[model samples]
Target: MCEIFSKILQVPINHIKPIDYVPAAAAVNRPYDCHLSNNQLINLGININCIGFEDWWKNYLNN
Candidate 1:
């Protein structure tokens, strides 16, 4: 989820890189996965701003 991390860390999309392992929560501040699906969707022109649970909550509350 580069989009999620970009939103969380306040960084640009290209700044995120794929990792082979999911870092421990303590190290990363939250569990993260390096699935390629999100990247694929982005390449396909699908805007994915809410891929994770926290984003879902934010969207729900905002609505």
Candidate 2:
């Protein structure tokens, strides 16, 4: 899911933030928890980008 979303949102898989709660991200305007994963939530800032959705997307897409 994240892989496919990465293509659509134009962001890397590492930048996506996931959680038990979805719909908080999932935006082309920004980079956030764009998809819901069944995996355990282990947030160490490894695969999460806290730069919000829109800003992160802009910066990410620019590169």
Candidate 3:
């Protein structure tokens, strides 16, 4: 997952630190529907747009 993010963002893995509040920021009041084992993998996939983000974000604001 780190590797993929590094490649996509063209940054080194060591430099690609995960944002501490990202999970909490992304999570809503709904139950956490993800499996811990696949969370990183799934997030990486989402980052690469292999999975659409429309359903992921209710009001996605892309800057």
- Which is the better candidate, 1 or 3, if ranked by lDDT? 1
Off by over 4 Å in 2: 1-49
Error of 2 at 4 (Å): 19
TM-scores of all candidate predictions against the true structure: 0.24, 0.24, 0.24
- Candidate 2 residue pairs in clash (backbone atoms < 3 Å): 30-53, 30-54, 31-53
Q: Write the per-residue lDDT of candidate 1 for residues 1-63, one digit (tens) a residue.
A: 567656766778875577778667646464577555588888899988757676775677568
Winner by lDDT between candidate 3 and candidate 2: 2
The candidate scoring highest on lDDT is 1
Error of 1 at 10 (Å): 0.2
Error of 2 at 21 (Å): 20
Instruction: Quantify all predictions' global Cα lDDT against the true fold.
Output: 0.69, 0.62, 0.55
lDDT of 3 by residue, 1-63 (tens): 556545545676775576767576777686666644657867677553344444333234323
RMSD of each: 12.7, 14.8, 13.4
Arrange candidates, best lDDT first: 1, 2, 3
Residue 40 displacement in candidate 2 (angstroms): 12
